[model samples]
Target: MAASRRLTQFALVMTVAAALAAAGCASGLGGGTYQRTEARRTMTVQFGTVESVRPVLLEGTKTPVGAGAGAAVGGLAGSTIGHGRGAAAGAILGAVAGGLAGAAIEEGVTRRQGVEITVRLEGGSYLAVVQEDEGEQFRPGERVRLLRDGGTTRVTR
Candidate 1:
Protein backbone atom coordinates (compact mmCIF):
# COMPACT_ATOMS: atom_id res chain seq x y z
CA MET A 1 0.00 0.00 0.00
CA ALA A 2 2.75 2.48 0.92
CA ALA A 3 4.77 1.57 -2.14
CA SER A 4 1.81 2.13 -4.40
CA ARG A 5 1.21 5.55 -2.86
CA ARG A 6 4.82 6.55 -3.35
CA LEU A 7 4.71 5.49 -6.99
CA THR A 8 1.65 7.62 -7.63
CA GLN A 9 3.24 10.65 -6.01
CA PHE A 10 6.40 10.14 -8.07
CA ALA A 11 4.36 10.06 -11.26
CA LEU A 12 2.52 13.22 -10.33
CA VAL A 13 5.79 15.02 -9.61
CA MET A 14 7.21 13.91 -12.95
CA THR A 15 4.14 15.20 -14.78
CA VAL A 16 4.41 18.60 -13.13
CA ALA A 17 8.11 18.83 -13.91
CA ALA A 18 7.48 18.08 -17.58
CA ALA A 19 4.81 20.77 -17.77
CA LEU A 20 7.05 23.35 -16.11
CA ALA A 21 9.88 22.56 -18.52
CA ALA A 22 7.58 23.17 -21.46
CA ALA A 23 6.37 26.44 -19.97
CA GLY A 24 9.94 27.73 -19.69
CA CYS A 25 10.48 27.71 -23.45
CA ALA A 26 9.73 31.24 -24.60
CA SER A 27 9.86 33.32 -27.80
CA GLY A 28 13.05 34.37 -29.56
CA LEU A 29 15.23 37.40 -28.81
CA GLY A 30 16.11 37.99 -32.44
CA GLY A 31 16.30 41.42 -34.04
CA GLY A 32 12.94 40.96 -35.73
CA THR A 33 11.10 40.07 -32.56
CA TYR A 34 9.29 42.74 -30.54
CA GLN A 35 7.17 42.90 -27.43
CA ARG A 36 3.45 43.46 -27.71
CA THR A 37 3.75 46.94 -26.23
CA GLU A 38 6.26 47.99 -28.88
CA ALA A 39 3.78 47.74 -31.72
CA ARG A 40 2.83 50.98 -33.50
CA ARG A 41 5.44 52.94 -31.57
CA THR A 42 7.57 55.25 -33.63
CA MET A 43 11.24 54.43 -33.79
CA THR A 44 14.15 56.75 -34.59
CA VAL A 45 16.06 55.53 -37.63
CA GLN A 46 19.81 55.90 -37.97
CA PHE A 47 21.98 54.66 -40.81
CA GLY A 48 25.25 52.95 -40.07
CA THR A 49 27.88 50.52 -41.30
CA VAL A 50 28.79 47.40 -39.35
CA GLU A 51 32.25 47.69 -37.85
CA SER A 52 32.33 44.20 -36.31
CA VAL A 53 30.14 41.28 -35.29
CA ARG A 54 30.86 39.04 -32.33
CA PRO A 55 29.02 36.05 -30.92
CA VAL A 56 27.20 36.42 -27.59
CA LEU A 57 24.68 34.70 -25.31
CA LEU A 58 21.42 36.30 -24.21
CA GLU A 59 20.42 35.25 -20.71
CA GLY A 60 17.00 33.87 -19.88
CA THR A 61 14.19 35.66 -18.07
CA LYS A 62 14.28 35.28 -14.31
CA THR A 63 10.80 34.79 -12.96
CA PRO A 64 9.15 33.17 -9.96
CA VAL A 65 7.37 30.58 -12.05
CA GLY A 66 10.29 28.20 -12.28
CA ALA A 67 11.11 28.32 -8.59
CA GLY A 68 7.49 27.98 -7.54
CA ALA A 69 6.84 25.04 -9.80
CA GLY A 70 10.00 23.33 -8.65
CA ALA A 71 9.24 23.87 -5.00
CA ALA A 72 5.76 22.40 -5.31
CA VAL A 73 6.96 19.38 -7.21
CA GLY A 74 9.87 18.76 -4.90
CA GLY A 75 7.78 19.09 -1.78
CA LEU A 76 5.30 16.57 -3.10
CA ALA A 77 8.01 14.14 -4.13
CA GLY A 78 9.95 14.52 -0.92
CA SER A 79 6.89 14.03 1.26
CA THR A 80 6.79 10.49 -0.07
CA ILE A 81 10.26 9.67 1.17
CA GLY A 82 9.53 9.03 4.83
CA HIS A 83 6.86 9.22 7.46
CA GLY A 84 6.06 12.14 9.82
CA ARG A 85 9.12 14.20 10.85
CA GLY A 86 11.42 12.48 8.36
CA ALA A 87 9.07 13.31 5.54
CA ALA A 88 8.87 16.93 6.61
CA ALA A 89 12.66 17.28 6.63
CA GLY A 90 12.92 15.63 3.24
CA ALA A 91 10.33 17.95 1.77
CA ILE A 92 12.16 21.05 2.94
CA LEU A 93 15.49 19.90 1.57
CA GLY A 94 13.94 18.77 -1.67
CA ALA A 95 12.19 22.12 -2.18
CA VAL A 96 15.45 24.01 -1.81
CA ALA A 97 17.24 21.74 -4.23
CA GLY A 98 14.39 21.78 -6.70
CA GLY A 99 14.11 25.57 -6.68
CA LEU A 100 17.79 25.98 -7.55
CA ALA A 101 17.68 23.26 -10.20
CA GLY A 102 14.57 24.70 -11.77
CA ALA A 103 16.05 28.18 -11.99
CA ALA A 104 19.18 26.83 -13.68
CA ILE A 105 17.12 24.70 -16.03
CA GLU A 106 14.94 27.66 -16.96
CA GLU A 107 17.98 29.80 -17.72
CA GLY A 108 19.71 27.11 -19.78
CA VAL A 109 16.57 26.41 -21.76
CA THR A 110 15.92 30.08 -22.55
CA ARG A 111 19.55 30.96 -23.31
CA ARG A 112 20.11 31.95 -26.94
CA GLN A 113 23.02 32.47 -29.25
CA GLY A 114 23.38 36.15 -30.10
CA VAL A 115 25.69 38.59 -31.82
CA GLU A 116 27.27 41.88 -30.79
CA ILE A 117 27.19 44.21 -33.75
CA THR A 118 29.44 47.28 -33.72
CA VAL A 119 28.16 49.99 -36.01
CA ARG A 120 29.53 53.38 -37.01
CA LEU A 121 26.60 55.78 -37.41
CA GLU A 122 26.40 58.44 -40.13
CA GLY A 123 26.89 61.06 -37.41
CA GLY A 124 30.40 59.60 -36.78
CA SER A 125 29.56 58.01 -33.39
CA TYR A 126 30.12 54.29 -32.80
CA LEU A 127 27.57 51.99 -31.16
CA ALA A 128 27.41 48.30 -30.43
CA VAL A 129 24.18 46.31 -30.30
CA VAL A 130 23.67 42.75 -29.16
CA GLN A 131 20.75 40.72 -30.41
CA GLU A 132 19.82 37.10 -30.78
CA ASP A 133 21.02 35.51 -34.03
CA GLU A 134 18.15 35.07 -36.45
CA GLY A 135 20.24 33.73 -39.36
CA GLU A 136 20.72 37.32 -40.50
CA GLN A 137 24.44 37.66 -40.62
CA PHE A 138 26.11 41.06 -40.38
CA ARG A 139 29.64 41.51 -41.64
CA PRO A 140 32.10 44.33 -41.17
CA GLY A 141 31.48 47.27 -43.56
CA GLU A 142 27.94 46.07 -44.37
CA ARG A 143 25.35 48.81 -44.50
CA VAL A 144 22.46 48.58 -42.03
CA ARG A 145 19.80 50.66 -40.37
CA LEU A 146 19.45 51.19 -36.61
CA LEU A 147 15.93 51.63 -35.36
CA ARG A 148 15.69 53.10 -31.88
CA ASP A 149 12.49 53.04 -29.81
CA GLY A 150 13.23 54.87 -26.58
CA GLY A 151 15.84 52.69 -24.81
CA THR A 152 15.53 49.80 -27.26
CA THR A 153 17.31 49.48 -30.60
CA ARG A 154 17.53 46.97 -33.43
CA VAL A 155 19.74 46.61 -36.50
CA THR A 156 18.33 45.61 -39.85
CA ARG A 157 19.41 45.40 -43.49
Candidate 2:
Protein backbone atom coordinates (compact mmCIF):
# COMPACT_ATOMS: atom_id res chain seq x y z
CA MET A 1 0.00 0.00 0.00
CA ALA A 2 2.77 2.39 0.90
CA ALA A 3 4.64 1.68 -2.33
CA SER A 4 1.49 2.13 -4.33
CA ARG A 5 0.78 5.44 -2.66
CA ARG A 6 4.29 6.67 -3.35
CA LEU A 7 3.98 5.71 -6.98
CA THR A 8 0.74 7.64 -7.22
CA GLN A 9 2.34 10.72 -5.71
CA PHE A 10 5.22 10.55 -8.19
CA ALA A 11 2.85 10.23 -11.10
CA LEU A 12 0.78 13.18 -9.89
CA VAL A 13 3.81 15.40 -9.55
CA MET A 14 5.10 14.48 -12.99
CA THR A 15 1.72 15.17 -14.58
CA VAL A 16 1.34 18.51 -12.88
CA ALA A 17 4.84 19.58 -13.80
CA ALA A 18 4.35 18.61 -17.42
CA ALA A 19 1.09 20.52 -17.63
CA LEU A 20 2.48 23.60 -15.93
CA ALA A 21 5.62 23.51 -18.05
CA ALA A 22 3.54 23.92 -21.18
CA ALA A 23 1.67 26.85 -19.67
CA GLY A 24 4.88 28.49 -18.55
CA CYS A 25 6.29 28.18 -22.05
CA ALA A 26 3.14 29.63 -23.58
CA SER A 27 3.08 32.58 -21.16
CA GLY A 28 4.09 35.97 -22.52
CA LEU A 29 6.96 36.34 -20.16
CA GLY A 30 8.88 38.74 -22.38
CA GLY A 31 5.83 41.06 -22.26
CA GLY A 32 4.83 41.92 -25.82
CA THR A 33 2.11 41.02 -28.32
CA TYR A 34 2.21 41.28 -32.08
CA GLN A 35 -0.37 40.35 -34.68
CA ARG A 36 0.75 39.27 -38.11
CA THR A 37 -1.26 39.28 -41.33
CA GLU A 38 -0.39 38.28 -44.84
CA ALA A 39 -1.97 41.36 -46.42
CA ARG A 40 0.45 44.23 -46.81
CA ARG A 41 -0.61 47.48 -45.18
CA THR A 42 0.91 50.89 -45.55
CA MET A 43 3.02 51.86 -42.58
CA THR A 44 3.29 55.45 -41.40
CA VAL A 45 6.67 56.39 -40.04
CA GLN A 46 7.28 59.65 -38.21
CA PHE A 47 10.34 61.03 -36.52
CA GLY A 48 10.17 62.76 -33.15
CA THR A 49 12.39 64.10 -30.41
CA VAL A 50 11.80 62.61 -26.99
CA GLU A 51 10.65 65.14 -24.41
CA SER A 52 10.74 63.01 -21.29
CA VAL A 53 10.91 59.43 -20.04
CA ARG A 54 8.96 58.05 -17.12
CA PRO A 55 9.03 54.59 -15.58
CA VAL A 56 5.86 52.54 -15.82
CA LEU A 57 4.62 49.10 -14.96
CA LEU A 58 2.76 46.82 -17.39
CA GLU A 59 0.40 44.70 -15.34
CA GLY A 60 -0.11 41.01 -16.06
CA THR A 61 -3.45 39.27 -16.32
CA LYS A 62 -4.60 36.44 -14.06
CA THR A 63 -5.13 33.07 -15.74
CA PRO A 64 -6.38 29.66 -14.66
CA VAL A 65 -3.20 27.98 -15.89
CA GLY A 66 -1.29 28.96 -12.82
CA ALA A 67 -3.97 28.08 -10.29
CA GLY A 68 -4.83 24.76 -11.87
CA ALA A 69 -1.22 23.66 -12.22
CA GLY A 70 -0.40 24.73 -8.68
CA ALA A 71 -3.37 22.98 -7.19
CA ALA A 72 -2.49 19.72 -8.87
CA VAL A 73 1.10 19.83 -7.69
CA GLY A 74 0.10 20.92 -4.22
CA GLY A 75 -2.51 18.24 -3.83
CA LEU A 76 0.01 15.57 -4.72
CA ALA A 77 2.53 17.03 -2.29
CA GLY A 78 -0.03 17.20 0.49
CA SER A 79 -1.23 13.67 -0.05
CA THR A 80 2.11 12.39 1.07
CA ILE A 81 1.83 13.86 4.51
CA GLY A 82 -0.35 11.21 6.09
CA HIS A 83 -2.46 8.15 5.46
CA GLY A 84 -6.22 7.56 5.00
CA ARG A 85 -8.45 10.44 6.19
CA GLY A 86 -5.53 12.66 7.21
CA ALA A 87 -4.00 12.36 3.76
CA ALA A 88 -7.28 13.19 2.10
CA ALA A 89 -7.69 16.29 4.22
CA GLY A 90 -4.12 17.34 3.56
CA ALA A 91 -4.58 17.05 -0.19
CA ILE A 92 -7.66 19.27 -0.13
CA LEU A 93 -6.01 21.95 1.95
CA GLY A 94 -2.83 21.80 -0.09
CA ALA A 95 -4.70 22.29 -3.34
CA VAL A 96 -6.34 25.49 -2.10
CA ALA A 97 -3.07 26.95 -0.88
CA GLY A 98 -1.24 25.91 -4.00
CA GLY A 99 -3.74 27.50 -6.35
CA LEU A 100 -3.45 30.87 -4.67
CA ALA A 101 0.31 30.76 -4.64
CA GLY A 102 0.46 29.72 -8.26
CA ALA A 103 -1.69 32.60 -9.43
CA ALA A 104 0.39 35.11 -7.51
CA ILE A 105 3.58 33.55 -8.83
CA GLU A 106 2.35 33.72 -12.39
CA GLU A 107 1.43 37.39 -12.06
CA GLY A 108 4.84 38.22 -10.67
CA VAL A 109 6.57 36.26 -13.38
CA THR A 110 4.66 37.98 -16.19
CA ARG A 111 4.76 41.52 -14.80
CA ARG A 112 7.17 43.86 -16.54
CA GLN A 113 8.40 47.38 -15.96
CA GLY A 114 9.13 49.72 -18.89
CA VAL A 115 9.52 53.35 -19.76
CA GLU A 116 6.81 55.61 -21.15
CA ILE A 117 8.38 58.02 -23.61
CA THR A 118 6.93 61.39 -24.46
CA VAL A 119 7.95 62.82 -27.78
CA ARG A 120 7.31 65.95 -29.80
CA LEU A 121 6.58 65.33 -33.45
CA GLU A 122 7.91 67.57 -36.17
CA GLY A 123 4.41 68.87 -36.87
CA GLY A 124 4.21 70.25 -33.31
CA SER A 125 2.24 67.26 -32.01
CA TYR A 126 3.03 65.50 -28.75
CA LEU A 127 2.87 61.72 -28.50
CA ALA A 128 3.48 59.48 -25.58
CA VAL A 129 4.19 55.79 -26.08
CA VAL A 130 5.35 52.81 -24.10
CA GLN A 131 7.74 50.22 -25.50
CA GLU A 132 9.51 47.30 -23.90
CA ASP A 133 13.07 48.13 -22.96
CA GLU A 134 15.56 45.89 -24.69
CA GLY A 135 18.29 46.89 -22.24
CA GLU A 136 18.33 50.26 -24.01
CA GLN A 137 17.75 53.52 -22.19
CA PHE A 138 15.84 56.54 -23.45
CA ARG A 139 16.29 60.12 -22.33
CA PRO A 140 15.31 63.65 -23.22
CA GLY A 141 16.27 64.88 -26.71
CA GLU A 142 16.56 61.36 -28.10
CA ARG A 143 15.57 60.94 -31.73
CA VAL A 144 13.08 58.11 -32.25
CA ARG A 145 10.73 56.85 -34.89
CA LEU A 146 7.08 55.97 -34.58
CA LEU A 147 5.97 53.25 -36.99
CA ARG A 148 2.23 52.95 -37.40
CA ASP A 149 0.61 50.02 -39.16
CA GLY A 150 -3.15 49.56 -39.18
CA GLY A 151 -4.18 50.33 -35.59
CA THR A 152 -0.84 49.49 -34.01
CA THR A 153 2.08 51.83 -33.39
CA ARG A 154 5.58 51.07 -32.16
CA VAL A 155 8.23 53.49 -30.98
CA THR A 156 11.72 52.43 -31.88
CA ARG A 157 15.11 54.07 -31.69
lDDT of 2 by residue, 34-112 (tens): 4446146787889999899888887655788878877887788787778899999999998998888877776776677
TM-score of each: 0.87, 0.76
Candidate 1 lDDT over residue span 64-146, tens digit each: 76776677777767777889999999889888887877767667767889999999999999999999999999999999999
lDDT of 2 at 123: 98
Clashing residue pairs in candidate 2 are none
lDDT of each prediction vs. the true structure? 0.83, 0.75
Candidates' RMSD to native: 2.4, 3.3
lDDT value, residue 132 of candidate 1: 95
TM-score of structure candidate 1:
0.87
Instruction: Enumerate clash totals for all models, in the order shown.
Output: 0, 0
